[model samples]
Target: MEAATRMSGYRRHFSDADNEFEEENEAEEEYLDDPGNSSTSIDHVSSGAVINSITSKSSQSKKQSSIQQNSNQTLIKEALLRGQKLATNSREHARLTKSVTYWLAKDSQPEYAIEKPGFKRMLKAFAPRYELPGRNYFSRTAIPTLFSETYDKLKRTFSSTEVSFFSATTDLWTSCAKDPFLSYTVHYITPEWQLRSACLCTHYIVEDHTGENLKESLLEILDEWGLDAEKQVAITTDSGSNIKLACRLLRWTRLSCFGHNLDLAISKGLRDYSIEEVLQVCRQVIAKFSQSWKKTRDLAKSQAENDLPAHKLKTDCTTRWGSTYDMIARISEQQRSICVVLATD
Candidate 1:
């Protein structure tokens, strides 16, 4: 009987635990099903808050990133502007102007070239913010300043004791406009044994090219440079009567230009009947090719095929016999190409 009572007690305990578990589950299901429940509403509000927090953080991060990018761009733009301003300042401007003047004088280009639209465009492409000077500035101010500085420096060099005696070479030539000019170049040895040469003057001759006129002009140049007349060892000049007479009047040792004499000798020798005939035929052939663009192109093609230099045919100058020799030599060098092109014609 006691054992049966113990079993009944155990059954009662398990039946009570099962009833409690079913009651808790029914309460949880009721809470989930009810839309108006406070606990469910609180959970929905918490989830929405988490989503809003994430969205706000993301937006703020993107905004900061955009602001940082804009700041970087602004800094770069400011740095560029500062650099451009520094480059175009007065000091740099003057330096660049001097460089431009030097380039123009060295290349023998006209001052007006800087003012051309194409040249200005090129400068803009190189340095967009830097402004180039006008032609008037280069021609008047920059060029004269450069000349004065160079003249002073050269005068100082000539006055130095390192250069004691110098030999001079002078020549007179007429420009295409019929304006005559005289040029004098001086050569000297430095104390270090370096042979140096410089053109002292190229003055325009308003008067005739008489011996007296040339002598006076030369003396004036020598005096202006503070060059001692006694220190001048010799002067080399062509075989012109007036120049020789001027050198004689100066009483300085005069030397005939060897190149000019050689040219003269070669020219005299080339006057032979057989050589003249040959040169005339060569001239005719050169002229024929020069006159026709088609033949010139064909000659270039033939030269490539023959593995020869792609040099154009040279025309001899009437005054320079060396050029005549050069013309004949060039013809000889390209003989195969010339023959091939002529055959095509």
Candidate 2:
């Protein structure tokens, strides 16, 4: 391409002067030997090749500059669009609209005049604000652009660190109506040794929650953040077969729920094998209490007299895991009394 651009000028220069051929080659050779030659030598040159080369360089430079300008403009436009989507509500839309407006104002064409009342009205109308006046703009906002900028800066800062570690916790549970859900939490630490939110979150939403579906979601999360599962340091989850398999695939350190472990061990070791059987009975007893309004009311009276924890009539699997742990602790501690009550029935 350089040679082609320089060809036209070479043709033009040689057409202008048919002579000075040897001296032109000598001058070109001298310039090659020592690049310190001033523009005076180029001006004196009568060679078409030399003039064409200079013109080619200028043309290439202009083309490069134009390409760079277009790239930057495209990047800003995409950033504005993607960043606005991350805003959660109408208030967020207004704030982001103002930001885009500010960038547009950089064009500074006579299209928007500051002195005009109409322009002032438009600016006032568009500039989204809050009572505190900057929370929307300044709070812990997550924008794709911010992520790009932060990742770039951190890339420079931590490129030398070889052993970056990341971890994730995941679990599966049946929701109300027996629909299943798989949840994952990502955890990572910065090169500075401070904890940072993982680049992944929530569920990867699929048609149905199955083992194959779970494997796909897990792989998708890692792929999105450019994470290698082999690099994961730890994973925490319940003792579900699918979860155990996924962790094994990643070859990470696995941790079972210690509370579940304790329950299993206690049930296995207790002298009164009746405790396990009693729990099965209590499960039905709890259902009886929860079956209708009347039973719930009677249980409430008993709770009131004994100053016991309130009994929620509704049956839901939605309580946090800690709630189950607490219930187990309570039943284990009150086993003697609970056993007597169940036996009398």
Q: Which candidate is the best by lDDT?
A: 1
Give the runs in model 1 whose Cα sits over 4 Å from its true position.
1-89
lDDT of 2 by residue, 3-48 (tens): 9989989998997675577779887788767756655566566566
In candidate 1, what are the lDDT values of residues 10-121, reduced to their tens digit? 9999999999999999997888788789777788989999999999999999999999999999999977875774354578667767778898988989988898899889
Ten contiguous residues minimizing lDDT sum, candidate 1: 81-90
lDDT accuracy of residue 185 in candidate 1: 93
TM-score of 1: 0.74
| TM-score, one value per model | 0.74, 0.40
Residue 1, model 1: Cα distance from true site in angstroms: 92
218, model 2: CA deviation in Å? 3.0
